[model samples]
Target: MLTLLVIFIFVLALTYFVTRWAGSMQKNKMAGSNIQILETMRVTNSKYIQIIKIGSKCFAVAVCKDTMTFLCEVNEDELAYSSDSRVINTEGFKTILEKFKKDKPDN
Candidate 1:
């Protein structure tokens, strides 16, 4: 029983170290690449709240210059889920935005 427990603990610690090391390597590799923030805002206006990168690949995600949100990369490589990957027949984003436009609340 004691032997099994020690082996389990060692395996857990090795897994933790490997995960952390792999994450750091990916970040540094991508950093060296020309992953630039293109001039586009998907959700917010005038703030560049959304960014685009055109390098070895392109991705769009919620990143801004204000630094309110930390730098986290959401790789748009594959489908997030099986359901979300299916085709959609709804109107385009512009139409939806215009339809939901609201006036500023009188503060």
Candidate 2:
């Protein structure tokens, strides 16, 4: 019983460290990529609206469970924004969350 407990604990700690290491590696990999998802909003259970930044351009896309439709390329000047306009700020996420929360049923 004691041996089994030791083995279980060892396995758990090994898994924890390995997972943390892999996550850091993945984050580093993504940081060097040219394409990034700036923001995403769920339109329905399986549908979403996403703003993605690829290199110097930004795109808006409608995403469904089985398909992704291109909406348009967003302009930086639309919101009096700078070149980094493609990236959604924390306030934008907060607003989107509030809108969804208000629309969600209490049940």
Candidate 3:
């Protein structure tokens, strides 16, 4: 009976470890896929850095006319972020980006 209990405990521990490892692997794979998506983008005259995700959104910090803006990509929509940026949905984010893209260039 003691031998059976020890074997059962070993199997339980193995199952727990496997479950944790699978979860971690899924997270890593998701991160990598998102990274690939973030890599494909175009930034204009601004001195832009590449993307780095903080949480849900992919972000690029850039400077235009000595001001900082965070360019965020969220679900195919883009957001131009300043200090006062509000959390936005995909459509709102795209609208903000369209407006930003239409700005007249500073001389």
The C-alpha TM-scores of every prediction are 0.37, 0.68, 0.33
Candidate 2 per-residue lDDT over residues 1-107, each given as its tens digit: 99999999999999999999998899788778998777788999999999887988989999998999999998745634347755645475688899999999999
Clashes of 3: 0
Model 2 CA deviation exceeding 4 Å by range:
79-107
Model 1 error, position 62 (Å):
15
Q: How close is candidate 3 to the true structure, as a TM-score?
A: 0.33
Instruction: Using lDDT, give the best candidate's number.
Output: 2
Clashing pairs in 1: none
State which candidate has the highest TM-score. Answer: 2
Kindly indicate the candidate among 2 and 3 with the higher TM-score. Answer: 2
**By lDDT, highest first, what's the ranking?**
2, 3, 1
lDDT for each candidate structure: 0.62, 0.85, 0.64
Of candidate 3, the 10-residue stretch with the lowest lDDT total is 33-42
Q: Write the per-residue lDDT of candidate 1 for residues 1-107, one digit (tens) a residue.
A: 99999999999999999999998899788767676654444556534454445565545455555544534444656424356434454686788676667543545
Lowest lDDT sum, 10 consecutive residues, model 1, at 78-87
Task: Tell me the lDDT of model 1 at 98.
Answer: 68
**Can you write out model 3's per-residue Cα lDDT over 1-107, one digit (the tens) per residue?**
99999999999999999999998899778865544323423457655455565556666656555776776555435645555444334465688888888895767
